[model samples]
Target: MSDASLNPTATDRWMLPEGIEEVLPPGAWQLESLRRRLLDVYQRWGYQLIVPPLAEFLDSLLTGVGHDLDLKTFKLTDQLSGKMMGIRADMTPQAARIDARQPGNGIRRYCYIGSTLLTRPKGVNGSRAPVQVGCELFGSDALAADAEVVCLMLHSLEACGVPATHLELGHMGVYRALLARTGISEAETVALFEALKRRSIPDVDHLSASLPENERELIRALPRLSGGLDVIGKARALLDHADLTAALDALEQVAQCVQKDFPDVDIHIDLGELRGYTYHTGLTFSAYRSGMGSALAHGGRYDGVGASFGRPRPATGFSLDLRALLPLIQAQATPPLAVLAPAEGGEALEAAIRELRRTRPVIRRMPGDALEDYSDSCDAMLTCKDGVWRPEPFSNRS
Candidate 1:
């Protein structure tokens, strides 16, 4: 229907759209291997794997807690039903739908690894499509659920070969409780939230200027509350309200539990840092390494996401982009010893090829395909010597 489709040129054939990429050679291999390993790790932790449809009704995709995801989603009209549909920008809401549909009231843990499409790139030179790998826990309000997910996230990073990572923890309850006490209107609260997210102290001062000086000082103090665990003490000293005090107590409890469980991970607290303020109800956290500008993986306790699906359950989870993680992973290039067998080989060579494949990979040499075709893929070649087929290094082949 289009001119480019009818008569494609060399430029069309070779080029790809910006923010999209193809994982070639070793990168593809590493992605697949990492995906499998992470999924396996999640399964061992009692999380069942589920695959939700890639595209669904727009309303269904946007149902609960997706204001951020909504802007990133790609939308289209379904021809058969003539209804709006959306490609998922994140899979957490879908996982929530699945959990809500489950038969009983017992706890449910779900894990998923799949590709998600976004309208915009997540970071500098990021892909529009990222392989999302994550797990969600539902039906538990205990701090242990938050602790479990955080520990699992740490194990996940360790499994992916990330080195010497740190954890930054925050509780949206702190800010939400403080805001509720301020008695500010919704519009002003949202404006203040955006400013705080940007860590713009001047804008916070400008926006909260109308509030009473006491309320304004508390709002202004939020962005300054980032550091090691002692920051919690400062937060408690600054806020005296009973509900706000309770929220700080919850933060202290969760942070202590996580520290006890994982003593090696360095923990930082940001009482004012409300990353998922609208959705996340309680303890929120993200993992970081040395060079990444953004978090490696992030999630938090979103207690009411299931309410939109007719079931209100406590939920928390985290997701990481597998494609983005490939660069962060300190992977050792242990390329498999692939044996290339000639097409003309008889049943003996075929049998040998099958047997070798069981131990290592085997690349079949197709008819009319040159040796160079298999050069980079295989390090060794199968040869016949005195009626016995054997594999020798490609460099040593005569």
Candidate 2:
């Protein structure tokens, strides 16, 4: 059916577009709790929280980042000013802009928790609007600084009650060097890179066939370059080019540092895993659990990204989608809050309700004609019987 025919008034209340949602039933307590816990972690680590404006000039938003991110940003012209504005699809660039505007003498740590809107293609299920919670550390490129961010991320996951999470480490330097060694045209290099991302070995093999003998060997070996810590040693041996060797050394150093401090943390090296924003310069890593198909958290070194924003500070940080974590983490069902029924013309009863709220989350009204029916919806029902407050038990399908 035509959209106009389905909603003749176009203003029909029931007709709404996809990719938008209403938060009803008021169960944001869990989400808020998660955010608070994460922010607490950031705070203890000396990262001050900041909330960047949701809208900015499209040019400002896309200034530093590469074409890939620029294409995905949602753009629109402001009606009042007739200036192009874009909704922030990512927060890191905004944070960089903020740092540039307010140049500091020393290092700065910033954290943010907010919602971002993105348009998902038709086949994808679930909400397109995602909640992004992340932290960025600026003005430090010390390898130890990068390690600290990874450690904090691991601890944050642990604080959130995530279990058996492992950190998969990789260096963008290694991946790019390997690609450059292939001696392929710029177009072919991009295609080969995409194939590696998709883990399509056959396609990579086909593409590598036209390259020099040494380059072909490097391309064909891409698939076997991932596993646990052993991949680091393999990468060191497999890569012969100078740039590739240097990248391998950096990855190895990070592996050693992580092992020294976090012995129990499962550290896997995937020389082929290259996924991050354009700002990522050196070591990049992500956290994953067995059940989730995607990384629960990912971040890496982006020393050059800050410079693009006019602040020549080295920075690195990671952000996790709290919504993505909900399905993976074990959810503890919170007991229903008690609903108190107001007494008829009783001032004392209202005072008592206010006192009760100090210790517990409370809902105020009982729904429906039958009081017994509504009782099950709350943890307990409070009502004044003969000028005395009484508590009654409530339950629902457990």
Candidate 3:
């Protein structure tokens, strides 16, 4: 009946919006573990990790990313300098900006694991505040370079214990070459690309109606060129234009190379999978799991995008959504160690706990605490008595 009665203080006060979240306790540990595992894989492959700042100037960030992303970035003005700054919605552009600023003599390999914030519709099911783990390779344009990135991604997923994942590959060059033959306007090309992304045959047909008859036929065939290894042969036949055929050939070569190294890996060719930042001038791909509705990792070649920033390097990489993989990893995780401590001897117990932590994660539970009463929750416990460590057997029942 009254405002205060209907809405309490917590409900009435303005707070941070829904999409953003606070990482706490176990979630923080899982986040750090995922980052560590991913970074280890990157380092083994010669990618040095780089941490770009959270805030960057608007112009630098939006250079290669399209208008849609620019609209989503969180904008703010510097308090002292009064310059417009934005919280980065993605990390790849920031890496590009960093590479442009600091020129390397030859090729550069970089990796990062960082948090990214994005605005999503209310009640979105998955995490909007994501932790992105990615690697970027610069100054190589060979199809072999693209295949290397794909292989590294597969290895990283395996290290993280993800099972039965498939890599869906596509060549943006093929689609762009077909578009070039049409002599269509930029607006028509963008419209047709968007239609292909959505896999809407009717929309693609309607959008290509104004183009030449030959162009329309090629555009209509895009949605059909997605499947297993056999799809590559179909694409080579269906795509008659020389440039398109050449691009498809390059993709086939890369696929064959990857299979040679990883004979059991599942690979798919999808000509209609057109999602990438505007900078990706060549190949693009995404990794998907069986039950996961969305891609767990996605990236592509951005040879020209780096050039826009004065670097003039060819690069490609993939970003894995660490947050999405957490649940699956947790389901298979080994239980952590729980150490019981004496209330009066916290200092000595803490010292021993620190030693134990080097080998395994330790959760401290004090004597006379409910955790001590219920030993079943812990793997094992160390009781502190007279400055000595006494290992105790954990009972199955409290």
Candidate 4:
């Protein structure tokens, strides 16, 4: 119905929209291998697999999720019902809906791996459609639930052979508590949060200058709050409000357990970082690897995301782009060699090719496809000697 669709140019035929990508051959295979490997790890940790629909009613998809996600979601009208529909930007909300529909109050662990579309990429040069892989644990608010997901996130990286350099821990409670203490207007609090996350010292100072001295000092301290376990100690001295005790203790406990599992990993605590889903209610974290500019994987305690679906379940989970880790995966799956079978083959030859394919690939040369066509994939050739169909080593000169 649009001009571009009717009068498409040659460039439009071949060019993908910015941030969209196509993974070809070896790269696609590698992505698949990593996806399966990570899913296996989740299964071993007791997470059941789930496949949420790619699109859903807009309200159902975005319920209780904040405006940040809402802005990233792509919305369109459904032809059948003429109601608003959205392509899911993140599967967490869909997983929450599934949990809400389930019949019990017992804890549930769900894992999902699927491609999600976003209106804009999260970071510069990031994918618009990322293959998101994650596990969400619903029905428990215990710190143990949060820690389990944290430890599981580490094991997931280990399973995929990605060596994480460090993990940063923060609590949504700290920010919420700080906000309560600041007594700033909602508009001002939103502006301050934006400035703090960007670490814009001048903007942060200017924004909070109107606040009381005690609260302003605490607000200004956030940008400098990153790094090492000593951050917690500094936070306690600076943010020594009575309400922060339990939140800080939870941070220490989670950090201590992570240190036991991954002793070499640097554990940094930041009370000021608000780097997580807006729905996150308590602890939030991000894990980093060497050479990556942003967090490799991140998740936190978002206890009430399910409540928007009419089920007030506690939830925690983490998701990372499967293809994003392709380059960083320590080992690559060895591409299997194939046996080339001639285009003209008898039933016996067909049977032999099928059997060979059962174990490894067997490339059947199509009509007019010369030996040169099979050179890339085949290291051997299928031939009939006397009465037996056998594979013999063959080298096609290029």
lDDT of 3 by residue, 80-100 (tens): 788898887789988887777
TM-score of 1: 0.92
Model 1, range 179-261, lDDT digits (tens) per residue? 88789888888899999999999999999998889888998999999899899899888989888787778778877887786
> How high is the lDDT of residue 225 in model 4?
83
Model 3: worst 10 consecutive residues (lDDT sum): 119-128
The worst-scoring run of ten residues by lDDT in candidate 4 lies at 327-336
Best by TM-score: 1
Task: Give lDDT tens digits, candidate 2, residues 307-394.
Answer: 6666677888888777666644425445355664543436776776777788765556534455555554566666667887765555
Model 2 regions more than 4 Å off: 1-12, 121-123, 181-183, 240-246, 256-264, 277-279, 328-330, 339-348, 366-369, 383-392, 395-398
Query: 39-148 in candidate 4: lDDT tens per residue?
Result: 88888889999999999999899998888889999999999999999999999889999999999899999999999999999899899999998989999988889889
Task: Evaluate all candidate structures by whole-model CA lDDT and list the values in order.
Answer: 0.86, 0.74, 0.77, 0.86
